[model samples]
Target: MIVLAILTGVLTGILSGLLGIGGGAIFVVAAVFFLGVPQHAAQAAAIAAMIPTAIVGVVKHHRNRLIDYRYLPYLAAGIILGGMVGAYVANITADIVLRRLFSAFFALMSIQMFWSSFRQGRKAPAKQQDHDKH
Candidate 1:
């Protein structure tokens, strides 16, 4: 169990570095499958773990000029509104239904991200045209 946790953490750290994302998904899976944690508790633990990881990541990205802090207000507004609605719905929903819904939501988002990245990879950036304005 301890070895599994250590291996999971190592894999998650590598994935997080490669993808530029927090290891929330990996943490959730590990907690539920390996640690025998409840789904909701796993989700909460995953989120809590993300706090410090995200802070350090943000610092690194900011140093690299990868962060556009100007858009934070928009991001925060959406997050706050969506979080409230999600929490309310989750509290009122049945466990099985919530689980299915969350699974579907994650699947859809993963597909979208995959497709966007694939398309971006196939496209070439616009080149300067000779007919364009000087």
Candidate 2:
């Protein structure tokens, strides 16, 4: 179990770094599907596990001058308030409903990503063609 936990953490960290995504996507899915953890518990654990990764990411981005610190307070304020509200809502919601909602969210995101990727692919060829003409 410990080994599995470590492996999951490593994978989650790698995915987070490579994808610029919060670790929740990998962590929650792994915990729920692979580890047989309950959905709500998995989500809570994912949230907890994300803290260190998020801090490290922020530090690295800050060091690279990629972060705009001026907006942090505003972003933090919204995250804090939104998190509180989301937690409250999750707690009150049924497990099945929460699961379905999560699935829907991911599905929508996947569609958007596919659309964006295809759009970029289409533009790339056009840009290359124009460059060749020049």
Candidate 3:
């Protein structure tokens, strides 16, 4: 159990750093599926896990000049407000319903990512040709 927990945390950190993602989905999936955690509990754990990881990731991103400071205020405000509201709503929602909703969200997001990748791949050759001409 401890080994699995450590492995999950390590994997989450890797994904977060490599992809600039929050890694909430990774935590939630690992906690619920492998650790036998309840959906609501897993979600709460994932939210908690975000704090340290987000702080570290942000520092690295800032160092790499990947962040646009101009939009920071608005983004921070929205995240804080939305997170509070989301937490409140999530607390009132049933576990099964939340699980189903999370599953559907991931499914839709995965499909969108795949479609975007395909479109980008198709455009790459044209972009390369244009670049070569210049």
Candidate 4:
């Protein structure tokens, strides 16, 4: 179990670095398949793990002046509301239902992303804009 956890963590870190994602998918899938954790617990754990990661990323982005701080309050408000609704739904739903839902959602997202990339490869490049107009 410990070995599986460590492997999952390592895979999550590698995927995060390579894909610029926070690895919540990795955590959720690992918890479900490997650790036998329920979907609600997996989701909660993924969110908890993301907090520190988001903090670090935000700090780094802030140091580089890459953040728009003024919009944070609005984003935070929406996130809080969504989190509440998600938790409520999770509370009422069966574990298998949540797991299946997450799995389906993830699979759809992957398929859509793959389709997007495939379509992108078939598109012709647009003409470059001349930016030095006087």
Candidate 5:
């Protein structure tokens, strides 16, 4: 059990680095699927796990000139309010329903990512034409 948890964390870290996306979803999925944690608890755990991972991600990306912090205030404000409401709703929702909803959301995201990968892969390189040819 401990090994599985560590393995999930390592993989989530690698994925977060490669994709530049937060690791919360992966953590939540691993908690629910592998660790047998309830949906609400898994979500709360994911939020807890986000702190260190987020700090590391932000620092690394900022060092590489990738971060634009101007939007942080607005985004953070919305997330804070939304998260409170989300948590309240999740707490009142049944575990089975929450599990189903999580599964459906994950599946949809996976399908969208798979389709987007293929679409992006098939794009031809833009050809540079000689503008001086008159």
Candidate 6:
């Protein structure tokens, strides 16, 4: 079980880095489906796990000069406040409702990503032509 959890964390971390996503998406689903954890518990665990992973990511990006420090205060404030609100809401929500909400959120995000990718693909030809004219 420990080994499985570790593997899940490793995979989640890799996906987070590759996709520029918080690991909660991967971690929650993996914990619930693969690890047989309860949905609410899984979400709580994922949120807890993200702290260290996010810190490391931020540090690496900061070192590479990829972060805009100017936005940190605003972003941090929003995150802290939003996290409190979300945690409170989640605690009051039914487990099944939370699960459905999470699933719907992922589905919508996937659709949006596909649509964005398609739009980018459509513009690529025009972009290439403009580049050639330069």
Candidate number achieving the greatest TM-score relative to the actual structure: 6
Candidate 4 residue-wise lDDT, 54-97, digit = tens: 88888999999999989999999999999999889988999889
Question: Among all windows of ten consecutive residues in candidate 5, which has the lowest summed lDDT?
Answer: 125-134
Please give the CA lDDT of all the candidate structures.
0.77, 0.87, 0.90, 0.86, 0.84, 0.92
Off by over 4 Å in 4: 124-134
Tens-place lDDT digits, model 5, residues 16-123: 778866688788888888899888898888888888877876898899999778998999999999999998998999999998988898789989999997786567
Pairs that collide, model 2: none
Clashes of each: 0, 0, 0, 0, 0, 0
lDDT of 5 at 61: 88
lDDT tens digits by residue: candidate 3, 1-134: 99999999999888876886668889899999999999999999999987887788689989999999999999999999999999999999999999999999989998999899888867788778688679
- Model 1 off-target regions past 4 Å? 110-134
Per residue, candidate 1 scores C-alpha lDDT tens digits across 1-134 of 89987887788889988986668777777777788877777666776777788788789989999988899999989988997887677677776676677678779989999999778765645553332335
Candidate 5 lDDT for residue 127: 45
Q: Encode model 2's per-residue lDDT on 1-134: one tens digit a residue.
A: 88898898899888878997878988888887888888899889988876887788779888999998899999999999999999999989888888889889999999999899888867787768688688
**Best lDDT among the predictions, by candidate number:** 6
Clash pairs for candidate 5: none
TM-scores, all candidates, are 0.70, 0.88, 0.87, 0.86, 0.81, 0.89
Candidate 2 vs candidate 5: the lDDT winner is 2
Q: Could you tell me how far off, in angstroms, the CA of residue 128 lies in candidate 4 after the best superposition?
A: 11
Model 5 lDDT at residue 95: 91
Candidate 6: deviation at residue 122, Å? Answer: 0.8
